[model samples]
Target: MDTSTSKVYHVDGYDSRQYLEHYFSDKPDLTFKDDTLIFPIENLTKIFKKGHIKGDLMIDLSTGSMIHYLLPSCEFFKRILVLKVKDRCILELKRWLDTRTGAFNWGHAAKLHVDIAGNSDQLQDTEEKLKSAVEHVVKCNLAKENMTDPIVLPPADCIISAWLLDNVCKNQDDYIRYLRKMSKLLKPGGHLILIGCLEISYYTVGKDKLHAFSYDEDFARKALGEVGFVIDDCKVKKRKAQSDLADYKAIIFIAAHKVK
Candidate 1:
């Protein structure tokens, strides 16, 4: 009953399958029927389909074992580099990529993606495209100076961080640090897309609760500006208490350009 208390869990041994099942689903309540739960992703998917992001390579920081959001980007970028904080997360992603027997099912999210694009027929083709675009699913630590060191990656045309920064950082300062780190991963003038929680203190993964930074739109815009990025687009959808997944007030989606 005490939701206020939360303990951070390392990505190494976390139950990724369980986490995936709880969040992404075909169930309308948690999926297509609810805009708050699905809008952030829907909005991103639409943008990618429209070719908002450019370049041959796209890099995603802290993919968190979910490929639903990346489906759209797969079409535009020939190569994608997805990084996860824990090796376990990277492994979780690979299981799906490998099409293992027990891999997490993303039918619901995929369906939603096509639904938003108004092209239900391309479901299977779109799924295959996503699988093909992802060239690397590797380990990463945003706190480090070199986010993906030991494996120097080429500068990206665009970068995306979805709910990873909010979950990893303990405070506003940490958020700024990671934002700067993420910005550096992109080429100058490259765009940065972020999907994050707004004013949320904690989120649950299975039975365990985890810490999250509670930040608003003002804080987000300022943080991006202070770190030398220009905002191109930002979308904020109010959060609905449909589930106890997290106590967030809203979800903020931002597309910004890194300063040269």
Candidate 2:
């Protein structure tokens, strides 16, 4: 498949429920849990526990209708606002947030969160805390100067974007442009905890294949520096599960602070 011809995520849109079922369901599949979930939660726990990333507000621009990613952050941040690129994703997230019928079960993820934090008994507490912290879910357009236009959000103390750039950016320049847009959401000296795939060009969600930017660690480091973020930590984990859903060689997690 030609990278140029791959389906663009923001334009072609996504099957939010299908995506959640495939990658994040509470099935017997342990591949996604071990390979994907553990890394981000571990790093997030480490960062938040150390009191490195602080402040009252934390904005999440993560891909899909992901709630597991917010579990650990609930311990530290006062308020969490989610920004979505598509309406479908927002709806899917709201289903879970509101505890509506047919909401994707995240019990497994909540357990994993508590287990990682060394308090396996806090599963329900973690979920409740996350729900309380997440205040709003707003629609956004990265192409616009004011991504959250008309809604006007205050500059955040921290922003966590997971796997969004890999799917949204068509090239290196686009990556920088989008990163700059995300950077603007943060105040001076604020932190950005970014999670993305390295050298991955496409990922399958349901029957559709979505485009992803194939960039290495050097490119990522350079892109962060170019956007005026001082990289504080960069961790990479090689692909552990042998699956065909995505062709990513490894996952990259970076914690960086905006240059004051």
Candidate 3:
């Protein structure tokens, strides 16, 4: 076992429900109004329209507690695989996906999903599709030789990593190593869509301080290109936060394809 990846984060005990509310909850209003929502949805829309994402298999490298990231594009893929680092995150997701009673209410996110897709009537069907589309929720280690263990997976056509690496990595080298590991999950010419925070070093989980790696778009672009990815486009969305959710100047979205 690799002790390097065994940095057992107390993240399972962290307050994920509160975190989701601070960032993605639409309980306040409709319209997908937050700046956090803007860049990801808009660029994902562009990616789908440009035919950059579509195929049988989509691998989700970061399965944050919320499913908003999948709402925009999971339909494009026939099979979806989600990997998470914490049991708590997987538990939270299963509560929703399995429609259990104590599920963290994602009605607001579902409503916002319809807002992003503009399919007023597809809401119910979308939820059903999501529940069925996700093939599995497995634990993963980015530092390992095989990220997903026991179950060996075939290469994927598209990979999604949202607000992921920057939050989990402690430095630039760590970030690049994780990126290289994630890139290997894709088939040749497969697309990679990354959503990350820009210029930030830490995030809060209720009261505990969770550290992150500070970075900019140029560094991200260069890193991805050097890691066997052909750059497509990069978009940044800026917004001021009213809470201490995460300190950063902007949200960076990158679209790239595996070149090797």
lDDT of 3: 0.75
**Model 2 lDDT per residue over 34-71, tens place:** 55677888888888888878789999997899888788
Residue 227 alpha-carbon offset, candidate 1, angstroms:
1.0
| Worst lDDT 10-window in candidate 2 | 1-10
Deviation from native of the Cα of residue 119 in model 3, angstroms = 1.8
User: By descending TM-score, how would the candidates be arranged?
Assistant: 2, 1, 3
By the lDDT metric, which is better: model 1 or model 3? 1
Estimate candidate 1's alpha-carbon lDDT, on a 0 to 1 scale.
0.77
Q: Is candidate 2 or candidate 3 better by TM-score?
A: 2
Error of 2 at 13 (Å): 1.0
Model 2 local distance difference test score? 0.87
Kindly give the stretch of ten consecutive residues in candidate 1 with the minimal lDDT sum.
28-37
lDDT of 1 by residue, 1-260 (tens): 45566765443334677666656655545532354337666778767766657789899885368787787677678899888887767788888889998787878778777888788999888777888899888787665699777888888999887878787778889889988887778898998999887888877767777787888999999999999999988888876556667778877899999885
Task: Say which prediction, candidate 1 or candidate 2, comes out ahead on TM-score.
Answer: 2
Q: Please, what is the TM-score per model?
A: 0.92, 0.96, 0.89
Backbone clashes (count) for model 1: 0
lDDT of 2 at 200: 92
